[model samples]
Structure formats: structure tokens, C-alpha cells
Target: MSLRTVARDDLKNAARSYVVLGVVGVFAALVALVFVSERNIYPDPYRTLFDVSFMTFLVFPLFVAPLSYLAVAGDRESGVVKYVLGLPNSRLSYVLGKFASRASVTLGAVVVALLVGFVVALATFENAPNLGRFATFAGVSALYGVSLTGLFVGVSAATRRRSRAMLGVFGAYFLLVPFWFGFLPIVNIGTVLDAVATTFGTTVTESTRSFVNALSPATAYLYATEPVYSGVTDQYPQLAGTFGGESSRIEAQLWFNVLTMAAWGALGLLAGYASFRRSELG
Candidate 1:
């Protein structure tokens, strides 16, 4: 079997999973809730879209972590990897196939959730949702989800135990999502930095903070979508910096945010494949 065969089989298996179904359902429901609740408050289509997209950015890693953390680790723990590798499939094919199938699942969920948002907007709002802006948001969301999938899939490929994989991915999720920004005070980097800055009267540069935030896939996703909210509304805050402004810092550029996202996927895949290739299936 080639990568295509593995991917096809994996997709079929994922389709039958209740966890996948639940994640997709929850994601769609959240988007719908945002649309229904915020429609009256934010009448502008772009503002509503920003709210929905921001909500997605915050919760995306939660939805994707479960779908991806067990992609290969579960198979290995269950001894299915031995039988699968006994076929014509190489380790590279297996990893690529898993990535493709999981990425497809993630993208599929994004599409479903966004479609639900669009339909709800059409029904509840006076003006129809802007198709171009909606499509752009959808595209950025898909890229963000897929990038995160690659990271978790890499974790799955590297770990032999399911528990370790789960811990690794979710631990990553907390660190990259909540704790990165001081939602959890004790462990939050941002919070710690703020305390230190306050105590020492040392200030962190905006460029430095921008670079730190750009390190996260979630923040990078926000940075990449900044252009969509450019002229529409000021509701969406800039995560990286001003896009295409006069700033000479690389973090201020739109291309840097886009590249940050692409790099996460590529680096995760390469790192996972390297570790997986060295693993002993026996």
C-alpha cells in the first residue's frame, strides 16, 4: 500500500470515530452561538466575522489536539503498526498518509463550522454575509488548523505510548494557547514577563513582544488574517504588528505571519518524520 491507500483507510477510520464527531459538532455549535448572540451587538458583517474567527482561533487547538494526538501512537500501542508496516507501506508513507488524512479531517471540520456560521448569519442578520470576506476567513482558518494538526501528528508519530502522546499534545495546547498569554498566572510567560518588567522597571519592546506572540500558531493565524479586517473594522486587534506599515521590523510584515504558519507545519512534519524513521516498530 502507498500513501494514498493509507490516507484513504485512515480517513475512513476517522469518519467512524465518535470523538471526531463530537469535536466537529462542538466547533460548529460554538460558531453558530457566536453568530446568533453577537449578530445584534455587532451588526457589521466584518465585525461579526472577526468575532467568530477570534473565537475559532482560541478554541482551535482544543478541537485539533484530540483528532491528531493519537494518529500513530494509538496504532503503535494497539500493535496495528506492525501489521501495517508488514505491507508495502514505508514509514515515510505511513507518516505522510496520517498527516494527509488528519489534515483533511481538520479542514473538513473548518468548512462545516464556517458553513454553519454563514447559514446562521444569512438567517438572523439583515445583510447577507460578505462572501469574499467569509471565504478569506475560512481559508486562513483552514491553514491554521492544518498547521496545528501537523504539530500534533508529529507528536503522535514520535511517541510510542498513547498517554505520552496525549500529555505531549495537550501540554503543548495549554502552553501555546492559554498559558502563553497569562490566562494561567503561575505558568504564563506573558504574566511572568509583565511581573519582571514591573519590578525592574525594564520595558519589553513592542517588536520583541510581537515576535514572542508570533511564535504561537494561534497568534500567527491571527496575524495572517489581519488584512481581512484592515478597512472593515478596528475590532480586530493586531497580534504581530501593523501589516504593510512603515515599520522595518520583519515581524511587522504580513509575509512574516504567513511564513510563520507555513514553517510550523513544515518543521513539525520534518521533525516527526525524522523521529518516526528512527523508531523501532518491533
Candidate 2:
């Protein structure tokens, strides 16, 4: 079959995954509940929704990691990959096809979940998030999911063994990504910056430090999708507490956040493509 044809079939198969369905269901339910709570418990709807957006940081990894892991590693373990290759498919095509299929499913789930959040928020507060904010949230959220899918699938493609792939991807998700966050706080970034300044005669501001700290995908996604709810006090007099509050905001621009996510995906794809090309079947 042609590459596109093969990719289409893969998409269909990926869509059938029960894991994907479960994640989507959970995401939708959580979003709905958050909105439902906004109507009752949370007096400040904007702040409440802002807090709710942080859940995306958790959901991005939760959804993409398993889907990408099973896409290649499971097939390899079951010997399905050998059959797939025998059908005149290249390893590169297989990797790309899997990326397309799995990433689409990841993105689709996020969109549906966000849609539920939007509808319920409108119904509850009689006010919806700004149109621009919602669009950016949906688009960036989808891209964030895709980037993660590429990263995990690439890791999975690097090994034919399911166990190894699982270990590596899990390490990346749990340990590696969070490492930057933990390491930065302990290691004295100021000292590191001083060394850079001494050597290169350049100064770094706190804003620059904040930007650098956002290098991790987790931080980057959080920064990019942060809801900016201006004039919430004027619109909903009850939600004035949400106005002028400063928490959970990050210091990177939208472009930098996008680039950070894209870089993770690109690096993963390159790593997976290179390694998978030389990988031996069991």
C-alpha cells in the first residue's frame, strides 16, 4: 500500500484504542466537573477556570505517552511490525505514519475535552473565555499533544523491545522532563549566569532566567496556555478576586513556548527515525 493509504489504516487502528477512549472520557468528565463546580463552589469563575487549565500539564503526558508507546512497541512485541515491513513499507514511513495517526488521536481528544469545558463554562457563568484565548488554548493545546506524541513514539521506535521502550519513555516523562524544573531551583542558576557573564561579559535578567527555566515541555505548555482573563471584575462583579491576581503565570512568549514544544517533538522524531532505521527485529 502507498504511504498515505498505510497511514489512513493506521489512523483507523489508532482510533480504536480503548486507552485513547478512556483518557478522552476522563478528560471530558474532569473538564465538565470543573465547570459544574464553577457554578456552585468557586465564586470566581475566571480564576477557577485558570486553575483548571493547569490540568492540561498533567493530561498532555498522560494521554500521549501511552498512545505513542503502544503504537510501535506493542506491535514490535507482537511481531506485527515484521508483517508490516513485509508489505513494502520503509521504517521511516512506519514511524511517520504512526506519528500522524497517534498524534491526530491525541489532538482530537484535547479538542473534544476543551469543547466540553467551553460549553459548560458558558452555561455556568453566563460568560465564556475570550474568543482569542479559547482559540489559542485549543490550538496550542493540540500542538502540545502532538509534540508529546512525537517524542514518545520516537522513543518507542528507538527500540524493538517493548520493555526497553517503556522504560525509556517512562524515564523521559517522569524523570527527565521534571529534572529541569527541580535542577534549576537547586543548582543556583544565578551562579551559572555569573560564570556566563564573567566569560562572555553578558548579563542575564530575572526575566531571562524565567524564560530559560521554561525549557522543559511541561513548563513550556503551562506558560503558553495560561488564560489571560482581563476585565473579569468588570464583567462578573462577584469574581473580582480573579482580577489582578498573580499566580501560575510564566515568563515566556507564545512563540517561545511553541518552539520549545516543537523542538522536543523534532528531536524525538529525529532520534527515533535514526535509531529505528538501524533497529533489528527480534
Q: What is the TM-score of each candidate against the true structure?
A: 0.90, 0.80
Q: List per-prediction Cα lDDT, in the order shown.
A: 0.84, 0.74
Q: Which ten residues in a row have the lowest lDDT in candidate 1?
A: 233-242
Which lDDT tens digits does candidate 2 get at residues 1-282? 556766798888766878878888887788778778767655444555566666777655866777888778888889998998889788888888888888888878888887887777777765455556666677877888888888999998887778898888887886435455554554444566667887988888776776676787777876666444544445454344533334444444667778998999989988988987887886
lDDT assessment of candidate 2: 0.74
Candidate 1's error at 177, in angstroms? 1.3
User: By TM-score, who's the top model here?
Assistant: 1
Q: Which residue pairs come into collision in candidate 2?
A: none
lDDT of 1: 0.84
Q: Summarize candidate 1's per-residue lDDT along 72-158 as a digit string, tens digits.
A: 999999999999999998999999999999999999999999899989888888778888878888998999999999989998999
